[model samples]
Target: MPLVDKLLILAIGAQVFLAIAILVLMGRERVPRVMSGEIPVADIAVERSGYPLKARLLSNSFDNQFQLPVLFFVGALLLLQLGFVSWVDVLLAWLFVALRIAHAAIHVTSNDVPRRFAAYSAGLAVLTLFWLWLLIRILLVPSA
Candidate 1:
């Protein structure tokens, strides 16, 4: 498989793992709160602490994975289908994945807005470039 394909798979895997982690975090906090009668139910409502800070952060991070990253997934698949794999595309795809991971880390750990924004912006830029490169390749290369 091409490096871009591998990276795309890994990025999808990261989203799945992050979702599981978010569920675990929610259970960890909600179970205890409910058992101790602090919260009447295992609900993530604004009234009941709103899923704790960490859980909320992880949930938000998980949500972000589904947004712009969808473009990366579609771009990679389009490149594969078009038989236009290149090192430049692979590198950009990997860069986007790394930046997204960094963004999630900053978001879930310190919840620092500026740091997370920097990472998110970098990832979005890479993804945009990847799509542009794909367009260029498709327009210039003749079909097989």
Candidate 2:
């Protein structure tokens, strides 16, 4: 496989693994509480108000995996499909993933808004550049 393809695989794998880890962490917190009738099924079913802070933190972090990274996923596939892969693109992609992991770590641990926002903003900026760079590259290239 090409290096870009490998990067995409690792990126996807990382997101998947993170999601699974969050699920396990949530299960650790949720199962006992639910089984003990501490949190009603209705509350969890309707909304997360019933979930405690720890579960909420993990849940929010899990939710983030689906957010901005969606663009990364799409952009990655586009890059592969269009054969527009470059070292700069790969570096930005890795940076985005790393920042997102940092954001999730802070969110689930300290729930620190300032630090989380810094990581999130940086990742968002990188994602924006990723897309903008891809778009510029596509527009600059003449169709065969």
Candidate 3:
């Protein structure tokens, strides 16, 4: 494997870790409430009046794992699949991962909308750049 490929894998690994952290947080926050009859089981399927703020934050963070992060996974895999590897790709991948982590941290901790949005927006930009860079490379460089 090339160094760029390894870097992408590591960045993806960081994303997986963030997902696991959110899962664990959800478990810690939800389990106690559910067991204590504070949060009803049926309400777990969606955000509702019965849902507490901490649980909602964790749930939202977890849901976000399937959102923009999907683009990250696809972009990383596509880069590797088509052999478009470079330091720029690696840097942008890491930047996306970092911003995502920041978003999650703000979400689950303070639930700060502005800070979280900034992180998420920056992450989306990084993801877009990654995709655009890959597309340009694919169009310009003929595969040998």
Candidate 1 lDDT, tens digit per residue, 1-144?
766567656655665575576567667866786678766664644553545676667667777878887787788778777668777887787788778778888988998899999999999899999899999888887767
Whole-model Cα lDDT of every candidate shown, in order = 0.76, 0.88, 0.90
Task: Record all residue pairs in model 2 with backbone atoms less than 3 Å apart, i.e. clashing.
Answer: none
Instruction: lDDT for model 2, please.
Output: 0.88
TM-score of 1: 0.78
Candidates 1 and 2, the one with greater lDDT? 2
The C-alpha stretches of model 1 lying farther than 4 A from their native spots are: 1-37, 42-49
Q: Which candidate is the best by lDDT?
A: 3
The weakest ten consecutive residues by lDDT in model 2 span 7-16
How close is every model to the real structure, measured as TM-score? 0.78, 0.92, 0.91
